[model samples]
Every structure is written in structure tokens, then in C-alpha cells.
Target: MNSVNNTDAAKPAAGLSINKRSRSWWSAPLREVLDLAFPPRCLLCEVIDYSSNSHSGSYCSECAEQLCPLPINRCLCCGAEIGLYSMSENGCTHCRHRNLRFESVTCLGMYEGPIRKAILAAKWSFSAVPIRSLGRLLATERREELQLLKVDRVIPIPQHWRQRVFRHFNPAWIIAEEIASALQVPCDAHLLYRQRQTRAQKRVPVSQRFGNQAEAFSLQDMHVVDGERILLVDDVLTTGATCSEATKLLRQNGARECHVAVLGRVLDSSA
Candidate 1:
């Protein structure tokens, strides 16, 4: 991974930043003791044979290497794999006429294989873990790409009040805080609000996802994003209707630009 040079920025809340305790003088010895008490295991593959990396770091090298890059020929607009370049126009046929709203989108890779496995674990199995372990893992994995977006602030796609109560967490919010720290940009989790609970995009057909999310978001205040370049963070990018809707609100409220970063992107062959 590339080194980050940004100065430390104020955190969104406690436990959102990488646990600094891991860097403490007592941290190593404490982790060593814990390792002795219970043999270390790979968090992803669950192997018991592992050495000290970080107190929270648990993936083995083989698992880490599974995070491959997106296809070289991709839509410059949305990061979807569009096969080899077909023309001077950068975006794929589906997106050529549609305004994506965001300036650009960065994704770890196609939503399959190891990255997909990790995202499933993050969103479904382990919401209670501090920092959302899968999010912290992916955020650390994708830090370099995120820094290059050069956005002024980070905002997580907001969860409606009812969703948060049911899920007890927002994976995007946790991922946003982890990324905002590395980018050294302020993170504002409250910048957007979900006015209505929309149907999960995964449950709806790709053709209908855009309309499902169209009226769900509202900018908290016009003055908050006045002339700001914002980075909208989310767990995954499929049809991208979610981010586009949120970006539309932010842009309408005076955000100068909006870029997106997601843990994974689904390349829709069915579309």
C-alpha cells in the first residue's frame, strides 16, 4: 500500500479511527500476551497460525493478495468494467447519456471473490465489532486510492432512523471515518439525511433501483456544503443509483463536486 502523508484530522466519533492503542508502547506486549493465551487466527480464513502484525490485523498474506484491481478497460465515469476501449468516449453505452452526478467513482474491484466475501461479512455478520472489522480492513486496503480523490470532506450515505434501529450500525459510516482519517479530511456523518426508508437495492431489479432511491435523501443544510468538494462513501456500488441520488442532493445544495469510493462494484451483465 502507498504511504499516506496527510496530517491527522479530527475524527467523526470515538472508535472510528484506527485503534491508536495498537501503536502504544504497551500494545505489543499486551498483544503478545493475548496471543499466548489464545493462538492468533486469521480473521478472514480463520487459521490459527499467524504472527503479530497489528492487534486488529488478522488476514494472512494469501488472503490480502486476493484483492485484485478492477478491469483496465472501465467506464471512466462509474468504475464499471466496460471491456476494452471501444471509442473516444470514456463511459459505457448505458452511462453515456445519463449524468452520474458524481465527478468520478473509485472501487476496489468487481463485487466477486474475496472482496465480495469480505463485504458480505462486513454488512451481514459482524455489525457489532468495533470499527466494523471488514470496513476497517477494506478501508486500510484502499487508502491510497481514496487519498487520490482529493476531496475536501467525507460523508457517508446516511441510513434512515428506522434502518439504523434494525441493523444497529451503518457500515458506510464506519468506512467513511476510516477513509476520512487517511485522507486527512474532515468527515461529517450528519451532512445527509434519509427522508424515507427506501427498498434495499439488492432486493429490487436493477432497472427499478434508481426510482426506488430517488426521493430518499435531503441535504441537512445548504450552508454546510457550500462550495465544498465532497467524497461520498458507501459499502458497494451496483447500479450507483444510491450515490447518484445523494450526490444530486449535495450538488443542488451548492457542493462544488462529489466523488465516490466504494468497497466493491458490481458489473451488471444482466443490464
Candidate 2:
């Protein structure tokens, strides 16, 4: 039998290590050059984010401070801001009588100020950057709450084919993907789909919003959702109409539990 050349075998491993170091050595300077050429900007405010501690390269220090996490005084069911003294076991006044299908909700912040502007910019521009940053921020800030839910899958509230074609991107899908990545869960955009094009929830009055989304969504595959704990993602939760309708379908189709994660939660003044 021929003697094996152990030294030759070790040379290849050492060469591989040298190559990796070489690549890493060059990558740092290249990154610095690129960053110098295109300084990072706040994803929301579009201002230079010089702060080294910026959240996910998304917000400037000011914007980050302004976009702080929602206070603990929010309603657990609907994620609406409420006075600390007003919380109850069943739910807050906003969702006490309302028939919300999702088990609970988490939001980065109330929809206003910087958060509102960021969401609006993301929607109008059809840009994924801001929304992606917002999603990552949401995941980072709400990691504990989200992890406690033990969700098996992440799903974005789907858009109608027509609207999707027009928009060129689905904000919900982008947000869902980021959150799913953070949670190490699968993000399935096609498991659920819009059955019909419904009027924009914003266009419809609050009382009519639920009706608008009724029958607007259907499941493409029920087996995937059956007995699975799901985390539904959306850009914003306004009247909770869209999410509610989506959750109802999941629950009806045997989803064991459904939770919601939204970048912003619109505070209902009437509530």
C-alpha cells in the first residue's frame, strides 16, 4: 500500500485558510470605501445616520429615539395605546366588544410621528429598504414577546393580484420575510392569497372595513396551516379589519393559534 502524504493533505487546508484571510483582509477596506462613497442614511428620515449605534442601519439617533417601542400600557388584544390604569384581563376598551380573530398583537410603535412617516414613505415609494429596516427593528425590539409565542411559521397578509401588479412589491411580504428570518421560521407568501380585489381599507369607513375584507382572502393550502402556530405580518394595523379577516380564515382552516406583528398600530381616537 502507498504511504499517504499527510503533509500534502495539510497544505490544502492551510492554503484554504490563507485564501479566507486574504478575502477578509480585502473586504474590510472595500467596505470602508463603499461606505465612504455612500454614507449610510436613516431608512425613515433619509438623514445621515452617523451614530454607530443606529438600529440596523435604519434610523438616525433622533429618529431612533422618536421611534421608541410602544409603551407597556397598550392593549394586549388590539395593540392600541391605553392608559396604564385602564387595562383589563379580557381586553382593552377598544377590542373588548370587537370580534378580533388573532390571539394577540405586537407593534413597533403607535402609528404617528416618525413611524407613520416611515410607513407612508415605504408604501408610496414601493421601496423595500425602509420597510425591511422597520421589520428588522420590530423583530429586534419585540424578540422576547415574539419568541414567547413560539410561532411555527410567518405569513404576510396577501395582496390582490391586480394591486400587487400595480405596486410591484408587497410591503407585508417584505416585512414578513425579515421577521421570519429573525425568528428562523419560514415565510410563506403563497399559502394564503387574496380571492378578490377589495376596496382599500383606508377608503372604507371603520364600520365598513371588516365587510370590505370579508370573502376577500382564501387559503391556497390548508394543510400547511393546520395545527400550526402562525405569526401574521403587516405594514400597519389600522382598523384591524384586514388582519382580523385574515386571522379568521386561518382559524377556520385549523390554524392552532394566530398572532400578529405589525410595524405600526394605528391608534383609534374613538377607542
Candidate 3:
């Protein structure tokens, strides 16, 4: 009576292992049946994608081509598209005189065409498909360049709790998670937080954008960021004010380096 029932104790573990194996075995066939029943459609254009490289069945061939990395030259400092002969070593004309806190910026493409439509759809749609697709595409397109940075952590530019409640989802977090998964780094959504509500950067005038973002963010734990190379992610970069403020906070907290990644970069200031 006092002795433990070793054989009985082992039964539970054995049963759990068999259950896991059963689930794994059935998963692929189940997914295949589901796919046949409801063929995958492009998230952006809602067209059935028959191509193999449909980006996990998220985009059709035409939309995929539209979302491919742009061939235009981009400023390393601010991610602005520059003239073929324009200097980009220090900063482009767009950000040369401005105080941009991030070391460098990377983006999938300019904020127009399919990229713009995908981003705009992501905002109002409750479905995670659009944002997740955009995030995965960004990760796939920028894998090599992002890997070179050797990022220690991925952090999304956070939203205020009120905004989060209103929006019901944070696109940045999803994007950061995808990039972090690709980079094999941790995505810490809670590391940085917006401290107060501010006017949308798009709505604010370019001249007042920096002031609008001033003191808008705070960190949860500075110790986690100390000496770490961080990659800050967001859905779009308009004037670079929001990301700059976030990067400034990370650097002030002792982050070794901070890099920015966004799905879209607005080429026109008025956009």
C-alpha cells in the first residue's frame, strides 16, 4: 500500500505519447482534406492561388509579383527611396538633417499598390490572414539582410491599451513575431509600450509629427534591453517619427543597437 504504483504511473505518460503521435499522424491528411474542401485563396486579392510559390497560399501569382521586393534604391538610414546617384551612406536628403535614432531601416516596398491595400485591409479586418501574410512576406524577402544584423530580440512598436482595445489586434506584433520566428530570436511584444494616446502620425502634419510622438513610449524592463541588439517592427513607416521615438527609448535604455523593419514605407510625405 505504501509503495508507489510505478507501472500505473507510466501508463499516463505512455498514453500521452501515443496521443501526440496520433495527432501528428492525422494532422497532414486532415489539412489536405481541408485544403481540398476550401482551396486556399490570396488574402490581398481573394483569388484562388494555384501557383506553388503563393507565399503559403496567401497571395496569387499576380499579387505575389506586386508584393515582391522593389528594385528602387533605398536610403539605409531612413528607408526612403533615393535617386540612383544620391548618397545614402550617412543619410538621404529626407533624413540627413533629422535626428533618426534607429541605426537602419528595412521595408518590403513602398506604401502603394498591393502593399498599401494589404496594410489598409489589415487595420479594419478582424481576420489575422492579411497581417500574417504581410509579415511572412516581409520575413521571406528580408531574411538575408535581417540575419546579418544578428538581432538579439524583436520588439513591436506597442500600442496604447486603449488603442489595442479599440483595434482588437496589433498588426505590428504579428509582423514582429514572423520576423522573430525567421530570425530565430524572441519576439517580446511587452518590452516596449505606448504610454499615452497620440494622434495618428498619418493625420498629423509632418512638421508636428515629431512633437506628437515625443514621450509617447516607455519600456517594461530596461535590463532586458541592456547591451542587446533589438529589431523594432511596425506595419508602416510614414515620417519615421513613431519608430524614431521608440528607437530612442530603446537606445536610452542601453540597447546596443536598434534596427527598424516595416511592411510599407511612404515615399511621399503627403501620403
Best by lDDT: 3
Which candidate model has the greater lDDT, 1 or 2? 2
| Candidate 3: residue 58 lDDT (0-100) | 75
Error of 2 at 8 (Å): 32
Per-residue lDDT of 159-225 in model 3, one digit per residue for the tens? 8888877886889988887898788788899878888999987788788899999999998787888
Count of backbone clashes, every candidate in sequence: 0, 0, 0
- What are the per-residue Cα lDDT tens digits for candidate 1 across 214-241? 8899866779888989999898887889
TM-score of each: 0.81, 0.87, 0.86
**lDDT, each prediction:** 0.73, 0.80, 0.82
RMSD (Cα, Å) of model 3? 7.4
Clashing pairs in 2: none
* TM-score of candidate 2 relative to the true fold: 0.87
- Model 2 lDDT, residue 242, Cα: 87
Tens-place lDDT per residue, model 2, 27-66, is 8787678678877777766776655433334787677667
Predicted structure 2: clash tally: 0
Model 3 misplaced regions, further than 4 Å: 1-37, 51-57
